[model samples]
Target: MSDIEMIRAARARIAGNLRRTPLLSAPALDAIAGRRVLLKAECLQVTGSFKARGGWSAVSAIAPEVRARGVIAFSSGNHAQGVAHAAREHGVPAVILMPQDAPKAKIDGTRALGAEVVLFDRERDDRDAMGAALAEERGLTLIKPFDDALVVAGQGTLGLELAEQANEHGVTSAEVLVCCGGGGLSSGVALALEAEAPGLRVRTCEPEGFDDVARSLAAGEIRRNDRLSGSICDAIVTPQPGNLTFPILRRLCGPGLAVSEDEVLRAMALAFRHLRVVIEPGGAVSLAAALFRPEALTGETAIAVATGGNVDAALYARALSTLE
Candidate 1:
């Protein structure tokens, strides 16, 4: 089977594990974007993020012997908790490698799910390298956060839910918005929508500091950002777009837009006030594009992926304190 086929198969195998999260129109955002807006509330998903979809998909795909060895993963936060939660359900142990600078709430949340957490430095070493080494040393099945095909397909299931939700709610031809990191969630989602709901235009939103996906698409090659600065959207600190994911995004998604730290923080507060959902800065960036970059998406219905609810309470409070 092709990569897309494999992804589809993975989705089929893991269909029983995920939630069909709500996709609802935000009347408030309609007034802001000047277009009807919908939010896919994946933050309310099982692991408090959309990462659970990919985690469970990859976990359940393993053969009995492979799964018997247990699993290990590396994530900034969301995927760590995702692996922990999925492994718990599958009766296996999960180990997660996270950057030392990751939010305390994310560290605590991953640990709370009973996964062993190991902290490292993004400046010194990559999580993929560290995770691969650990997985090899311990003979554990490794699940990548955003680069694996199974993981990508699993993340695509969110699109399945969105399409179903859109049909159910009588909203079609809307834009499906996702916050871009390594491109796992959006790639999978775009593919799913392409296959299932061709009318939907899948789009990506990212922090200005970590705009590799958008930049790479423009340059037609992978471009790395040597310095990442001023992003409240910490979950989206990817230095470069994944090779497999970049091509997918290039072909499957429409023009990806970026926003500032101020924009993301403001959007985060807006979601909290209007949707009554806790969206981390990264997740809120998609909505930020919808709100602040409305001219880029005029006349089209928009949907923002509320990718995760996991926020650093201290950070959130700080952001809120500065609100005007």
Candidate 2:
């Protein structure tokens, strides 16, 4: 549903609202990965994640009269803060349903952004049903985290930037690794690259046990994760790939990659050391794959998108301690 045209329109609509995060590279990272590696430091993006792009794209596209009624969304954390910030900017009320065990930093961040935060059990509660009911009751528009076309289109804007940046660096062909949850960012990036930089392919990256996207891509159909709440990569632990995003991923992305929790922590530590960018566990998976799973990659270069930086202080300290 999200094509290059819609993605370009999203970029235009969200112009001046979102930051075009930097594409960074360090010789240290390149040496570790055994290839030229570019890190799209989206962790430095507004709201501390790339989700802001999609949130603004979706919220801004709503009819002005309807947008005034407000909007609702369900996220583990990153998307919650994104939608919350966007709604606050538009001067509309926002209600976000977040998993009870999401990082405390994310919960507080969402509330600080002027959105009412509602907690739900990730395993025992159905967020979809609850979000729908709340939307109907409050006359709010439902802004789906990934399944919406506008959200995908909005996220695709990141790909457009990446494509141009890669070209500027003389990277004509490389594997663009994306930290994928329900595949919103990956699918959107895949779609954008397919048109603007066909030589740059997207590869979905996930934590080992919560690799539904990887397994689904291997099977050529959707596959559900057996458990959703155990991974420390909470920002990206979704039960399944989104219906709208999976097909795009299957068609445009390469084989999905899974990295261990230990690998992710190490990647976070290395990112902080070499790139000076703090990355949450979920956001570090792509870098983990790029650094540790080099056997699966092709070409002489790789691009990894560091998706978020909203980690709890304790967790971040623990990740940093790994280097000692």
| Strongest candidate by lDDT | 2
- Counted clashes in each candidate structure: 0, 0
Error of 2 at 113 (Å): 0.6
* Candidate 2 clashes between residue pairs 3 or more apart in a chain or in different chains: none
Worst 10 residues of 2 by lDDT: 122-131
For model 2 the TM-score comes to: 0.99
Off by over 4 Å in 2: none
What candidate 1 gets wrong by more than 4 Å, as runs, is: 1-8, 126-129, 228-230, 322-324
For candidate 1, the TM-score is 0.94
How displaced is residue 123 in candidate 1, in Å? Answer: 1.3
* lDDT by residue for model 2 (61-107), tens: 99989999999999989999999999999999999999999999999
Residues 1-324, model 1: lDDT tens digits: 115576677668776677778875667878988888888888899878999888888898888788977899888899999888889889988899988888899999999989989998877777677778888988799888788888898888888778888888777687777998889988888888887788888788888868888888888888887765346787777778888788888887888799988888887787777778888888888988988898888456888898988898887876566556
TM-score of each: 0.94, 0.99
The models' CA-based lDDT, in order, is 0.83, 0.94
